[model samples]
Target chain A: MRIAVQAESFDLGAEANAFAAGVAGAGAVVTFTGVVRDLPEGGLQAMEIEHYPGMTQKAITAIAEEATQRWGLCDLLVIHRYGRLAPGEAIMMVATAAAHRAAAFEAAEFLMDYLKSRAPFWKKEITTAGGDWVAAKDADEAALDRW
Target chain B: MMQVLYFAWVRERIGVPREAVETEAATVADLVADLIAREDRYAAAFADLSALRVALDQELAEFDAPLAGVREVAFFPPMTGG
Candidate 1:
């Protein structure tokens, strides 16, 4: 299991390949990447992300650990970025490997759902109109109830 | 003295990232009450506790959680991560 919390951007395809190669005997690998998106009205210059320095890594690691235990995952990787990101730029990614596709897919979705609300990061969208902090969605919170 | 940190709009409202606070408060809510009494910015930021979340020593906690041995406390809106 690997968890990285950094401001630097990453290469999604390369990282996915590396994660797959490293998990030798695993039969399935699933990867999900999150990207910065523009607003419906369209003038998003960037999305500035802020995170609690000490807590971010700890929280993500704990979440990944839980995923591993619950899914019996062979390997997992999570990379999250903190700082300004332009629209279309990759923000973060999660990869999961398991003996079968079901565990790999389920674990990846679980990781994303938990990270959506449980992580310490916050996003502020910078549009031409001005900046606004993204509000926590009720749907995201309710997603946890499924688990 | 305990280190109190703020994030996102809470930091913007309080006008600082973190500070060392001397308090006699027993719980997170008590500390918040003292801060609100001390300054208008704090009051505005903490006006609605329901919209906010607290972390005691980097772990998500409740407003009524004790602050006895906690070295750090953080206040922020609900996380919108992922």
Candidate 2:
């Protein structure tokens, strides 16, 4: 498993290829990328991401470990960005490899679900009006129940 | 001395990111009470516990959790990570 919490942007294609190539016996690989979207009014200037340094890594590692143990993943890669990012920028990506497509897809979804609520990162949206912290959604928390 | 940290609006409201807090508080709730009594900013920040979350020694924890050996405590709003 490889986990990176960085401020710099990453190439999605390169990352996906690297993850797939490293897992020799894996038959399936799934990659999911999250991108920033403009607000309804379309005035979003930037999204500032704040995270707890030590805790952020620890939380994500734990979540990835659980995914590996439950799904018998051959490999997994998680890369999350921090700091300010404009709309349309990629925020993060998760790639999972397994012997079958089912495990790869399911583990990828599980990682995304846990990362949404459990990771120690907060986002503040800056727009023409002002900056506002993005509130946590009940649906995001509820999504965990499926796992 | 415990390392008390705040994030997001909690840090903004309290006007500090982290501080060294010397306290005799037994539980996380007691530590919060002490901070609330220190200044209005702290009181305002901690006014609604339901809107807040706490971590003890970098792990998610409840407000009533004991702080006997905890060296670090953090307060922040619900995480919106993805």
Candidate 3:
């Protein structure tokens, strides 16, 4: 499993292909990319993500390990960005490779779930009123409990 | 010594990213109460524990669990992770 904490956007095709080829037992590679959406409808603006330097990456790596142990995943990659990000930019990516699509998909989802609830990251939304910290979403935490 | 972390609004209210405190907390809940009672800033930051989540050594944990030899504790709002 490969986990990355970076500020730059990534190419999904290259990452997916690499994961697919890396593991001989892998027959499927599933990925989920997160982009900054303008609004409920569609608009373009800016967003900022904050994270603790040493701690953030460590936390994510541990989450990836958990997913690997639980799902027997062959390969996994998690790339999350920090700092100011404009709309349409990729903020995070979770790619999982496994013997089948089910394990790959579950691993990807589990990675995301643990990352969301466990990692130490915060977001600020820029709006007409300037910028403010994003509130924690109950659904996100609840989603983890279900797993 | 236990390392404590504050995230998001909790960080803003507490005015620090992290703190190392010496404690003999019997449970996570007791530690929070001690922190809030330390000062107005802590009180304000931890005023609403309902919206907060506690993690013991980076894993999500319940409040009533014993602190024991825990080296790290973190407080943050419910996750909005994808």
Candidate 4:
């Protein structure tokens, strides 16, 4: 298991390949990447993500540990970036490997659901109108109930 | 004395990221009540407890959690990570 909370951009393909290669007994692998979305109304200049440094790593590690405990995952990787990013830029990624596809897929989804609300990162969008902090959606919170 | 930390809009409103707070509060809620009493900035930032989350010693915690031996406390809005 690897969890990286960083400000530098990551190569999703490279990371995924590396993770898959390093896993010894993984028959299946799954990867998910989150990207900064361009607003439909346009003028999204950038997104600034702020995080609680000490807690961010700890929380993600705990979440990953939970994912491993609940599933038969062979390996897991999580990379979440902070700092400034532009629209269409990758913000974070998660990859899971397991002997079977079901465990790999379910663990990846569980990681995402927990990370969306539990991680200590906040996002602010800078647009032509102004900058505004993204509010945590009720739906996102509700999404946690499934797991 | 305890180290108090704020993040995002909480830091923006409180005008500082962290501070050493001298207090006699017994719990997270007590500390917040004291901060709200300090000035309007804190009062405004803490006006709605439901919108805020607390952490004691870098662990997510409830406002009513005790602070007897906690060395650090943090306040911020709900996380929008992922």
**Clash totals for all candidate models:** 0, 0, 0, 0
Per-residue lDDT tens digits for candidate 3, residues A1-147, read 777888887888888777777887888888999888787754436888887666677788888888888888888888888888998888899998888999999888888877876787778877766777778676777878867
Let me know the DockQ for model 4.
0.94
- Candidate 2 on A45-98: residue-level lDDT in tens? 999999999999999999999999999999999999999999999999999999
Candidate 2 ranges with C-alpha deviation above 4 Å: none
lDDT of 4 by residue, A6-90 (tens): 9999999899999999999999999999999988888899999999999999999999999998897899999999999999999
Write model 3 residue lDDT over B1-82, tens digit each, in one string: 9999887788889999898998777999999998987899989988888888888887778988789989889888765554
What is the model-wide C-alpha lDDT for candidate 4? 0.96
CA lDDT scores, all candidates in order? 0.96, 0.96, 0.82, 0.96
DockQ, all candidates in order:
0.94, 0.91, 0.43, 0.94
Candidate 3 CAPRI level: acceptable
Question: Please, what are the lDDT tens digits per residue for candidate 4 over residues B33-59?
Answer: 999999999998999999999999999
lDDT tens digits by residue: candidate 1, B1-82: 9999999999999999999999999999999999999999999999999999999999999999999999999999999889
Q: Give the CA lDDT, 0 to 100, for residue A124 in model 1.
A: 98
TM-score of each candidate structure, all chains considered together: 0.99, 0.99, 0.84, 0.99
- Model 4 residue B19 CA deviation (Å) reads 0.6
Model 4 / residue A122 / CA error / Å: 0.1
